[model samples]
Target: MTRPPAENQELYRFSTAERWVHRTSSTLMMVAIVTAAFLYLPMLAELVGRRRLLVTVHEWAGIALPAPLLAGIFFRSLRADLRRLNRFGPQDKGWAWRAMRYGTRAAGAAGKFNAGQKLYAALIAGATLVMMGTGLLMWFPHLSSLTWRTGATFVHDWLALLVGVLVIGHVRMAMKDPEARHGMRTGRVSPAWARREHRLWAEEEAEKQAEAESAEG
Candidate 1:
């Protein structure tokens, strides 16, 4: 492949392992969502004519949703990114509030992930756990009281709907920013884009590069 121009220099953003985790998890989530539609929509379920198979696929997809992240634990880059997502600093709080009020135009200092990205990541992770728990309850109805199973079914359906909406919103946001999508797709992003979008992270990366260069010199 041809290289990016010198004027638009690209720096490594996501590591190979991080990208692998993202790709694997996203594929699994999509499979879960599609199978969920087949199972939940009466017309679709009737048309599909394989309720048992669809249920098994959906259940397994939900169960395996966390597998990518679990495997990613062995990678330092993914671990570091998880740490960044976990911490909610004052800046993140302020950015989140302003972003809510004023949208993406709101000026804010952000790290690798903006407040919105962090919030989405947290919500998706939580929703996945909820999905797994409720799915298990519904899947193994014999293990729980009928009333408990019913409640689990109710929660699982609504949670799946919410997750679908969240996924759509996330995709829309990515579509609006091709540069951001490029970073995730290729594991690199132009320095200019990084500076504009994630100034704090850009500065940190620049310092690290400088230190590495100095050590080599």
Candidate 2:
């Protein structure tokens, strides 16, 4: 038996667990990426003179970074939503094209997610996978030949660069939508925010809640 959802409430969007993981993961990734960059840059390395600590930070960050995503899988709703984002359908592609037109021509309508968002998800996932792979190799260098370790080093560094660039764009987009940050920060967003940015998701949630209530009643 299910109870009816509060008719007009802006209940929590993210759970405490989700918020903890999101903030920790984001912070660790930022630290890892930035410290890693400094380690690679000759000028910064000369100034810091702490290559050992930077490498240590990078290695540990790689270990810490995947925890949130890994833990999030236990939350079925979040995992399912992630899969939806992972798969970009025909309409998604169309949205992308329309968004390009909107940006370039400034005359057309745009859909919920533009092409760039879809591409960002793909690239981010790719970079994360690469990072995990190379990081594992780096962490357990004794298991690999010298040649493999050398190759892994290059791959790891390059993928970190890609992740950094993609994440900056993600941050910029989030800043443009103030409510988006509030959603993660407070685990809730304004009703209008959901209706405007993700009406379909909101509608689906509403219908699901309605059906559950009907069954219980």
lDDT of 1 by residue, 75-151 (tens): 99999999999887766867877877877646587888888889899999999998899889888888999999999
What tens digits encode model 2's per-residue C-alpha lDDT throughout 37-70?
A: 7888887778886678888888888777777878
Residue pairs with backbone overlap in model 1: none
Which runs of model 2 end up more than 4 angstroms from their true locations?
Answer: 1-8, 103-119, 209-217
lDDT, model 1, position 147: 93
Top candidate on TM-score is 1
Clashing pairs in 2: 13-187, 96-115
**Model 1 has how many clashing residue pairs?**
0
lDDT of 1: 0.86
When superposed on Cα atoms, how far off is each prediction in RMSD? 3.9, 4.5
Steric clashes per prediction: 0, 2
